[model samples]
Target: MSADSTRGAPCANCGDYAPFNVGRAGPRSGKMLCDDCADDSVAYIVDCLDCEWSYTCEEPRYNWYHAKIRVQQEGNTHETEQRVFENESHETVWRNE
Candidate 1:
């Protein structure tokens, strides 16, 4: 049998190959997105009500994956934003506000 016949098909977003299964659903059900893409579909953000200290976290669609956070800081009216990727431990470090 061909690769597709045995492993279903490649993902539509990132072209990651996925195997067919009876319990698959959501993106996998339609062969649209891979596990990585599914986990990165939605993003969530939380901000401090007092300061410009805000951070965003991308919600995992299926599995726990590395997600980056965009941290924003306002210093003396000079706004600065930094993009920080999560480490192996899924931790993010920021400067004191």
Candidate 2:
């Protein structure tokens, strides 16, 4: 089958197929994933290089205040760093330096 034939094919992660499902590419593996699988994957991560503060999320949006609150709740007073990654290639899309 040609590449075009696989446009609405079953999701590589869930093996579910639907004509209206416009699957998303897996962030880590590049496999075609259904909406649910894609939304459940870890697409972004926040880490503090100086401390043990870390947070992860699958959504494209990240809450900086929430991350800070988490660090504070953990008694981590170190300066927190924010990092954003793309869902397609897992590349560093943004970083607070």
Candidate 3:
């Protein structure tokens, strides 16, 4: 597909302009997801293995938009960090420093 063809138009997944659905979280990241992709994608929650750092938001199928979440470490300290959910599995956590 031409770069300009998809400029600010249509769903990023299917290239169709009509019948678009907005993904509130995950890979879609609030972008326009076609009805097909929306149907195929699943919702997930992210949690930390070390402490009570669980992500409790309904994002799209495989994307995240956590740019300013307060994460409490094992020591009970708060820190602002950015995180992203990788796919529906939601097993990945990235810290933006």
Candidate 4:
């Protein structure tokens, strides 16, 4: 959750203190991660993962293990495009969006 509005604020990045607001999420967690945090997290994940691959900023915002995916490249193919995997042994129970 985020404030209704964030005016005259500090950059979540450099902390230079400017008019900044929350940024859109990247791969891992889904919260009101600031712009600076988002950038750092992206770089960190990219460097650690060692790939120029893309990601999906889809639903199941707060829980990755139970989220539905919406692909950026709807009509594409790759051997390992799925960023998150599901455990095959568990039976699935769908939830309303």
Clashing pairs in 3: 25-59, 25-60, 26-60, 26-63, 27-62, 27-63
**True-vs-predicted CA distance for residue 14, candidate 4, Å:** 0.4
1-97, model 4: which lDDT tens digit per residue?
A: 6655545444333555443343543233433333444444221111112334443333333333233333312212221333324222221222222
Q: How accurate is candidate 4 locally (lDDT)?
A: 0.33
Q: So what's the TM-score on candidate 2?
A: 0.29
Off by over 4 Å in 2: 1-7, 20-30, 38-50, 60-97
lDDT of 1 by residue, 1-96 (tens): 444435556766577675554244235433455655665554444454444555654545432222222332222122222323322122233332
**Model 4 quality (TM-score):** 0.20
After TM-score superposition, the amount by which residue 89's alpha carbon in candidate 3 deviates from its true location, in angstroms, is 25
What tens-digit string does per-residue lDDT give for candidate 3 at 14-48? Answer: 76663422332123455665655555433344455
The better-scoring model by TM-score among 1 and 4 is 1
lDDT of 2: 0.41
Best by lDDT: 1
lDDT of 2 by residue, 19-52 (tens): 3325443332434455665565233444554445
What is the Cα-based lDDT of residue 20 in candidate 4? 35
Better of 2 and 4 by TM-score: 2
